[model samples]
Target chain A: MYVAVKGGERAIDAAHAWLAEERRGDASVAELSVPQIREQLKLAVNRVMAEGSLYDPDLAALAIKQSRGDLIEAIFLIRAYRTTLPRFGGSVPIDTGAMTCDRRVSATFKDAPGGQMLGPTFDYTHRLLDFKLAAEGEVPAAAEVEAGTAQTPHIMSFLDREGLIQPETDSDTTPPDLTRTPLELPATRDLRLQALARGDEGFILGMAYSTQRGYARNHAFVAELRIGTVAVEMDIPELGFAIEIGEIDVTECETVNQFQGSKTQPPQFTRGYGLVFGMSERKAISMALVDRALRWKELGEDNLGAPAQDEEFVLYHADNIQATGFLEHIKLPHYVDFQSELELIRKLRREAEANNAAPSESAGASGGNLSGKMKEGAAE
Target chain B: MNEKTDPNAARKAWLSLLARCSAADLDALWTDAALDPDHTVLRTPEVGSVMVRGRAGAVGSAFNLGEMTVTRTSVRLASGEDGHGYVQGRDKVKATRAALIDALMQTAEADAIRAAVLTPLQAGMEQTRATRSAKATATKVDFFTMVRGED
Candidate 1:
């Protein structure tokens, strides 16, 4: 007789109680608020917003706090909450070209139209220990300038003017929404980009790194990276004009990959694109690289069989929620299967020893024959 | 194109203004109008969310950034004019009022609604923008360099 493991609910409740205590960590330290996370731990909030595909900073901060700063857990919380909300009609595509840039830079040109404004960045900061930050930190106010009226010209535009880069045809077709539909094989560029946008940041980063390290090596150069706010507009059918609805912060990345001329075409630079919510340049750049690598088929490049190049492999495993669920489920009970395997291995060992000791004796015995038949049936 | 002759263009501007107006402003406009407009709720005010998307590099393919809370409603005027309203945030009353205004604008009440609701809302929005810009300008700094006599 077997008694199954019970009291799981009570055990889970106790574990949760302990977890709450552990999350608090220290009594003297003050509790962190949602506003603090939203303002100070802004990058973490941005990541949750980007991967979760939801934009509310306040809700993202709350999720971060509830998940105890585990970003993937926060993203999972956001995604779960997002699915429950009713859908409103979609806004018209935002004009990124008209974005009021706060931080815009280009690596492709020596001096671009928008003079490389290195707005608040950690790129130049020395990674030295700051003991002052551990106690009470004070930040000096950054210099201010009138917000520029001119839209920062894209670096790729210059390349396009020279006929050096491939030109993309304007598309009027509505892209498929993965949230509404089941993911099918051979996803469109739009669908692939959507998966990469909300994909696990670290997983996409690793895949991008693999491409740089000889697998589907595309020799990517950062053509342009811009972080700014753009106005959202919705077209009213009754009224002939579209009107501005709201504004949101976004980060956009465009990478110019290696140039090549196919048999019929002239040499032209290819492009990789990435766009994410808030100021997440790293994710944007990584997404762009991975995006370009996945476009190998459309570009008529040979299938180098790179992980980044495999659309099915990348899109299917990109979602952290699904990946984590499958990974964590191994902790569940499997004792029955383990016990069966154990018995079979023991029986096999016994048979081998019996055959070695007295092969003819075992072969002639009716009892041995019956047992052997039962073992064979069990194996089958 | 003259806005006077273009009813569609003028209506769009008014609708957009209503969508952007604060809940209090919308209410004040409604009360101040003193128009006992008869209307039926075709669709009850519903609170929902929209997944806002952005194009990569502004011209590339679109990607979802996040969701924003919105309230929407539809109403029909007694005269059979239909109107709809969609606004950011979770204000049901504001959304309903907007829909009412939308319907009335299409009916014979267009001029009266323009004078009562649209004008005040537009003024309020412009004031808000001006105040924000003025505050932002106070912190503006311009960098310049002077040539020295030594040079």
Candidate 2:
């Protein structure tokens, strides 16, 4: 007996079960803990924090584990959870100048306020694969060093002192939160920066690369990039002074851009800024380039209509969670829409076939006007 | 997520109320409100109500009880403009308030109307919610009675 398929839900459950088994791998191997992932696979945790816009490394690690190391899926889980959270209120902006530097470098200068200290980087490491890592390797010895007494001040401040760059004014106006609200066109600078801070790393990198290769070319120099932990503090209304709530790792990048001043304005250097959760330098730098490109209108530069320059397009499509959710949702059942299209095509084909046959049959004895009715239907 | 505060959902509600109403009623409401004729163009849509059912939790799926208003409406102004508003609440005042803004958008002072009428109504709704919550908290009943037991 012919019948319509009714086991779609059942099949989905079975498939999910199979996926879970695949994620766990062999039964003989011990399942990894969230703490272990957070400590050992730290880069993944950083990416999750950067995109998810959540600074909690532990929750990000758990999400990574639950999503079978699919970083985008982890980000989606974090974002969905983040939306449900009630806002206690915003903390005062963290001062990165007071951050105890773990890694500080300036591409523009050899020695800045904080000397270049490349802490915990794979930059100098050999590219050879290590066979020892196949099995869990022993921990390395701790670095021999005195107490960390010095803190890193921002490199942009050096240029700021000389009046060589534009000063980012403190307006005390709160920025728009994209997470809480739907995005609208003509977003502000603060809103754009927020979007870039949580934007997809690879997408930002590609756009940055395109700019360097001469599409909507805005000359950019990596003025400074810093990675460190900063303290988050919230002020109690009754107490007046703010108290430290917690600490979070952040990577900040500033790019010096060449901007020719207008008749009303004097010649001055402009800047691009990038701030991301956790220690992600590549993401932070790339974010800066893309940020600068988006400021074409405010900068009084020509609108080349580049992908990076269009704030509406970039800000709208940045988050991997939103992009992946919308893209993957297309895979959901659309049989109803497909069926309607199928019926229309079939009806049109039948009419065309009948019209061709009618001319041959009615050519002998009647008014052969199949084309006339087809025209009438088309008109309607 | 609170659909009550969702602008799109609220707009839909306003539009649906407009559809269920007569043109005379809409005109009377606007006329009574003393809206400028040169600025307004009102167009209401055909809407049918439905019950939305679901589940809720702080960390799990939300349950939507099927008893909500679930009104959907569309509006267009003389400035070749269109708006879609949806609300799941049965507050007729809210529905008309949204329609009035949509109608007034045809005028040059559309933004002023949006700022004055719509923004305040939204703020008032939020204020009313806060006040209601405070009142409920003030009257919160706590039962405390002890039974003596021998071990």
Candidate 3:
């Protein structure tokens, strides 16, 4: 009779105790506060908010604190918490044109309606580390401008007016929520955008990088990139109007790609759009590039078999939570399967030795050979 | 009273008013008697998050910014009146009080609520806003130059 591994409960409890102690390393040091993480590790909080698809800065901060600065783990905490809350209703579509922009720029135009306001950016700064910044230093206030009602006109609108760019038609249909539904293949542009919005920033960046390296290369010019706060409003049936619910900061990017003229339509510059929660220009720009690449079919462009252009591949692998879960699950027990494989390999070797034959059967002997062939075929 | 009106507008106004009310004041405002009518919780007060979005640039496309915590509740009065409340933060009692007030405002006690709750809250918010604007204005710097004698 074999004694079962019944001490697992005690072991798990002890491990948890050890982990809690480890989390609060060096009792002499002050405990990290949620507000500190929210303010100090702002970029990390921003990433958790962006990828987690939840916007609460406080909760993101707390998640960071609890997760011990592991951003992906913090994002998982937020995402899990997000599923528990009941949705009130969908908000009225906000007007981006009415945004009070903090940082707005247009690479396509020498001069745009809102003259490039590069507020708090690292664009022109040298990469040299400022040692003094390690210590908390008060930042002097920048000049302020009176809030104005002048709406910023989109660059694409100008191109659209001149018939130089393809017009995007508005749809009143509600988009499918990925959170509530299982992902299906051949997703709509709306669904694709929704996925890309909450997709892993690093993964999206890599995919975008691949496109720039000549795989489905579309000469993309940053038509405009703006980061600012916009009012969120919801229609109240009782009030007979929509009222501003709140405000949040966002980063939006639009890329103008090379023109494609078809038999029925004249050559017009196509566009890619990206909108993410928070001040993340890199993610937003990358998302736009990937968005454009995925639209190759609809844009009447040749499918160059780029990885970014593969909708199924990109959507399925873009989520870091799912990716990490699948990758990490490998640490779990697979002893039974491994034992069977070991037995088979040993039996095969024994048979080969006894037969005294040539190594002809070696090619077909492995269990993974067929799958390897299939993987190659699929890649092609 | 001849042409009946939908109670939605009144409810929305009160809810919005309650949302803007100071959180500290809300604790003091909670009274068991003010929630006079028998009501059943349509939905228990629970905390959740809403994804705040913004349209940052020239394009009218909205983008996700992040989420904020909101506590919400709904209650139906015994007299067939329904009230809802949504407040920022995880304060359940505040959400409940707001919901109760919403239900009460829809009834004949609308005037009493307006006098007791709405007016004071609105005045307090206005005072806060005025004080903030005054502080901001005091720091405003105006730059001008006299005509240069050399020019």
lDDT of each: 0.78, 0.62, 0.74
In the predicted model 1, the residue pairs found to clash are A54-B66, A55-B66, A55-B67
* Candidate 1 residue runs with Cα over 4 Å from true position: A1-6, A24-28, A135-138, A236-242, A356-380, B1-42, B54-57, B60-68, B74-84, B89-151
Candidate 3 pairs with clashing backbones: A54-B67, A55-B66, A55-B67, A56-B67, A238-B8, A238-B9, A277-B64, A277-B65
Ordered list by DockQ, greatest first:
1, 3, 2
The 10 consecutive residues of candidate 2 chain A with the worst lDDT sum are A371-380
Q: lDDT by residue for model 1 over A211-313, one digit each (tens)?
A: 9999999989998888876766776554456665556678889999998797888999999988888899988999999989998988889999899999999
Give model 2's TM-score versus the native structure. 0.65
Tens digit of per-residue lDDT, candidate 3, span A124-165: 789999988988789775444443334567766788789998
At residue A84, what lDDT does model 3 achieve?
A: 84
Model with the higher TM-score, candidate 1 or 3: 1
The CA lDDT at B9 in model 3 is: 55
Off by over 4 Å in 2: A1-7, A147-151, A351-380, B1-151
Question: Candidate 3, A184: how far from true, in Å?
Answer: 1.2
TM-score, first chain, each model? 0.88, 0.88, 0.89
The TM-score that candidate 3 achieves is 0.77
